[model samples]
Target: MKWTDINNIAIALMDLYPDINPQYVRFTDLYQWVIKLNEFDDEPKRSSEKILEAIQLAWIKDAD
Candidate 1:
């Protein structure tokens, strides 16, 4: 999964952290978690705040 795979990343995050609320997640932690995803594959430096926000939003939606 690359940075563009927002939904996939969100799903992975939901699976990895079912107890945590995506709404309360900080960007710093989100960044680390995204980069560390087993299926994640992309330039870590390619991520931006906009991309992170999209991922977080998607995660929140999936968590609901």
Candidate 2:
């Protein structure tokens, strides 16, 4: 999944970190985690703060 796949990334994150609160996640850690996902396939440099924010927001909503 690429950075544009926000919803898919959020779902994967929720599955991987069910006990973690996305609202409290640091962007740096989030970036690392996303890049580390086996299903994630994209240029790391393609990510931006805006994209990260969208992923976090989606994860937050999914967690609720």
TM-scores for candidates 1 onward, in order: 0.98, 0.99
lDDT of 2 at 50: 98
Best by lDDT: 2
Off by over 4 Å in 2: none
Q: Residues 1-64, candidate 2: write the lDDT tens digits.
A: 9999999999999999999999999999999999999999999999999999999999999999
Task: Please give the CA lDDT of all the candidate structures.
Answer: 0.98, 0.98
- Model 1 misses residue 47 by how many Å? 0.3
Clashing pairs in 1: none
For model 1, residues 11-59, the per-residue Cα lDDT tens digits are 9999999999999999999999999999999999999999999999999
